[model samples]
Target: MLVRIVKMSFEPSKIEEFLANFETVKTKIRSFEGCNFLELYRDQNNTNIFFTYSYWNAEEDLENYRHSELFKSVWSKTKPLFNAKPEAWSVDKIASLK
Candidate 1:
């Protein structure tokens, strides 16, 4: 499995708009082919900061999603809300407790 994490920071005032937009597309994104898991997280100290954690079948599956129209559409709508550039990582599991 491939683990993908994205950290995003939105302008404090734009957070609500971003959340609303995310809610509208979250299901489609979670159900996309090769997506095994999808979730959202927010920083305890910074309500405007968020993270997306997801699992994919492989890197290719991730690439497919990145290139899809869904990504383009969603990203375009979400980009303007950012207070800072987003960061992302794709990692392999090196160890697990359970």
Candidate 2:
């Protein structure tokens, strides 16, 4: 499995717009091929900061989704709301407790 984490910092004033946009696209993302899971999290101290935690069957699967029109449309709407560049990490599990 491939684990992907994306941290996004949004303009505070645009947080609501981001949230609404997320609501519209979250399902499409979750249903994408090879997607095993998807979730959203917010920073405790900074409401404008958020992270997306997702799992994919492989890097290629993730790449396919990233290149899809679904991603293009969602990102185009979401990118303008960012206050800073987004950070993304793609990792493989090393260890985990049951």
Candidate 3:
């Protein structure tokens, strides 16, 4: 399995707008092929800072999602709200406890 993590900082005032967009697509994203899980997380001290953790069957699956219209539109709308460039990474997991 593949694990993907994205850390992002959004403009304080646009946090809700960003989250609303996320809500629109979260289910579609989760149900996509090769997707095992999707979740959102926020910083305890900084409300505008967020992280997303997702599980995929492989990087190629995520790439397919990235190339889709849903991702394109959501990312387009969400990009303008960024306070800083987002940080993302994909890892190949060798083991899992659960």
Q: How close is candidate 3 to the true structure, as a TM-score?
A: 0.93
lDDT of each residue in 1-98, candidate 3, tens digit only = 88999999999999999999999989998998889999999999999999999999988999998898978888999899999999999987787796
Q: Candidates' lDDT values, in order?
A: 0.96, 0.97, 0.93
Weakest 10 consecutive residues of candidate 3 by summed lDDT: 89-98
| RMSD to truth, every model | 0.9, 0.8, 1.2
Please provide, for model 1 over 1-98, each residue's C-alpha lDDT reduced to its tens digit, 9 standing for 90 to 100: 99999999999999999999999999999999999999999999998999999999999999999999999999999999999999999999899796
Which parts of model 2 are misplaced by more than 4 Å?
none
Candidate 3: misplaced stretches above 4 Å?
A: none
The CA root-mean-square deviation of candidate 1, after full C-alpha superposition on the true structure, stands at 0.9
Models 1 onward score TM values of: 0.96, 0.96, 0.93
Which has the higher lDDT value, candidate number 1 or candidate number 2?
A: 2
Range of the 10 consecutive residues with the lowest summed lDDT in candidate 2: 19-28
Cα lDDT of model 2 by residue, 5-98, tens digit: 9999999999999999999889999999999999999999998999999999999999999999999999999999999999999999899899
